[model samples]
Target: MYIKPLALLLAVFLASLRLAAQTAPAGHVVVTHLDSKLLHGNPGGENPRRRVSVYLPAGYEASPSQHYPVLYYLHGFTWNDSLIFNQDGMKTLLDQAIAAGQIRPLIVVVPDEQTRFGGSWYTNSATNGPWADFTARELIAFIDKQFRTLAKPGSRGLAGHSMGGGGTVRLALAYPGTWAAVYALSPAFLGPHPSYLPGPGVGPALRATSAAEAQRVHTTLAAVSLARAFSPNPKATPFGANFPGSLGADSLARRDAVLARWVLASPLYTLPIHPAALRQLRAFAFDWGAQDEVKHIPPTCRQFSNLLAVYGIQHTAEEYEGTHGSRIMGSTGRVYQQVLPFFNKHLDFSP
Candidate 1:
């Protein structure tokens, strides 16, 4: 009771610090590598042991009896597992959203699908690794075993951006029972488009030159990624994949075969083959920005949505007023405002 002024101030300061710590977000990220039997071999010579980012809810440690839903997020082309923490700000957004009571507490996991070519295109291949199968089978099983996941389809959600967004739809259809609700944000290459066509200067960029031409180099790398994903050649030299367009007269005779491969890879054309699989999803939603930088994305997304409607599938399709990357940035970002809420509405939180 007879405390001095200095002692009183110190007590107050300690109390404030404790309060701040309590009020701050308590959840954290765990960056680790997973050894996948499915991803064990990469013909392109990229690392086969994949990197993964896992986010545990604030009370994951405190509530041992509680099991939460698992949300599988796929990063876009040229992005690694750590990007959600950096450029996209997704890790921060998830922490804030859970702390603010905007969304349910859930586990979020993203696989580093970025290969030497830029992205794996979320496809299974001898060259790029079976990213598609690894994500659905190996990755999911590993997370459920390592963490307190609900461990069932109804309690699982899948979401992605760019190529990963396309992966969201592709995986949902390819493996219908793996996820309950799925959302695709600015899903790239939903179908065949003019952008997939080989334009001039592409070969030079693929051969690679100066870093000053980063944009071109990245574009070319992405093209090669697509080739590796959609039209791989186990016998080819270097990357063990076929370029979509004519690299030379040797590739010319097989031009239509390569082009058709990509067309069939698109989720737009694959819809008919897997309507029953998609219809099993609890919720299906996709959105694209009107001014997306990918010149063909807007049109392809439109065609994809139209085809879904034509096939009598019940889903959500949105056209927003931003660019591809714009909708997924900042506190007021669409991923926080839209994507998370979509899962919260559809995902089962029981048990």
Candidate 2:
């Protein structure tokens, strides 16, 4: 009896070890280096040599002719391609989801979007280069050519968190014909430029002589980064950027002009203009945490969902029980349970 019980315990321990090994694999991520023509000569001087992380599902090597639908996942502000490569338990969750047959096998791509000011926000800026174009055109073209991808809009999906979520919403709306589905998690959605202006010292901080000083003031750096994205002035001194009220003086006229441009870039403002474009999408969904640190995000997400409803555009929006950074790790099951299944249902995985 003792011998039998000991043997059973040994078997269970071995099985657990195997499961752990499968869940976290050091070799899961494949890094590809690309010399981007689109990123060349950016005023911010962000690296043109980029590293893209591609996660291949199990048996990808065995299925030589099976082309998989591609899901392009954008990381949050201050994050790079390494988010998917190492942190966040994304690979482990994906592997578990695939192994469990909860979702079909698909290719996941995470591209580096880090810029001089931390993140590009996945927007096209005179200073930051055309990130939206890079994602919708250049990156897609590169992936289809290199990987065994479905190679069509119906099989492609875009998803992101935080600033990347903002990018997902903007890019998907701007290039409705390019993506089959889109999912945004705790997106940083701005209403207007005037709404972004912070408390005192913001104006002076924007005038910082060095990148270190500018970045030290987080709120000011964020404002400046958005300015670089929306209202870049290549001739501006120091940072070579200008916002609505970067100077100590505030001008309503100048503020309004810049705010108008920002509103135009906003998904809330743009989605209403192109209701038909939104309606044509196969799937559109966004979710935010109830306790998101960005207090405005939950309300913004709700407002955006309502706008879609008003326009008669079909989409899904949800409020989950968590904070902004709560669900990113595989521990939460949001990606496996919600995100992957949404894409599975929408994206065309045939052939």
Candidate 3:
């Protein structure tokens, strides 16, 4: 009887140890509500205060003196920062990768870039406020100050999907000295001289007083939003001066002017002009789905890649078997196997 009791106690203790190990925190996902002064008092009325999610690897707390490199992730059009952790399983994937020694542990940050018009495309605008500045300058400063980071451009990496991917491309080029490496996943590239016409009912729909009415028409609304980011005219009536003729006038001249503005913002056009900046990056890579639903994405990405090749800029470009937003979840292994390892290889993690 004594032997049986002892055996039972041992079994219970072993189970308890396993349970404790399972229940212990793998890492931390801290959500901080940041009030961006850079985004304050914008015409769009998008909330200046936004949530930024920071992922601290396991042992971050224990290793007080040790600093880690930082990776800034930009999300797609509709997806905000929180989705990276809550829905996409970023923390869990990172934990598993770190445990397996597949990738070196580092800090990851996701900033909210949602606007009244769905997504900001991570651009600076009179209407959308200085979103690029908010991300590149202000947010970086905040992260460096708050966390124990390597805090240098050489130690930093940027990655994004879709709109965020486009942001990574634009931001990396514009701020050449900011990030050492860049990975753009299925970036939404509109080409150098995109000819975008306002969809049916775009004019009357934008005139609607409420946000719901404006958002009901998806395609036109998205165009207007991009126009708001690129060519914002606060003086224009109703919802400010947007592309494809603001509100009333459907003149060809006005439309041409709008397209001209968009051309100026296009990475396809800007990349050729800024070859030196592209060459300055330590590492650059972009990938798109083989069957990307966005018709323009693959061709544009290929064109952009060709442009890079023309300029003798070294970069990685791949086509994967997935659609837009399909591989975002940790189930895909793209983030764990590809993105993290890319950053680990390029980013300087010393000291």
Report, for all candidates in order, the number of backbone clashes.
Answer: 0, 0, 0
Q: For residues 5-56, could you state the per-residue lDDT of candidate 2 as single tens digits?
A: 8899999998975777576423267889777899998877778888899988
Residue range with the least summed lDDT across 10 consecutive positions in model 1? 206-215
- Ten residues in sequence with the least summed lDDT for candidate 3: 193-202
lDDT of 1 by residue, 30-82 (tens): 99888777766667666778889998878889899999999999988888789
Residue 9 CA error for candidate 1 (Å)? 32
C-alpha local distance difference test of each model? 0.81, 0.79, 0.81
Candidate 3 residue pairs that clash: none
What TM-score fits each model?
0.88, 0.88, 0.87
RMSD, each candidate, Å? 7.0, 4.2, 6.4
Stretches of candidate 3 off by over 4 Å are 1-25, 190-209, 245-254
- Candidate 3 lDDT, 77-114, residue by residue in tens: 77888877888878887776666566788999999998
Give candidate 1 misplaced runs (Cα > 4 Å).
1-24, 199-202, 205-216, 247-254
RMSD in Å for model 1 = 7.0
- Greater-lDDT candidate between 2 and 3: 3
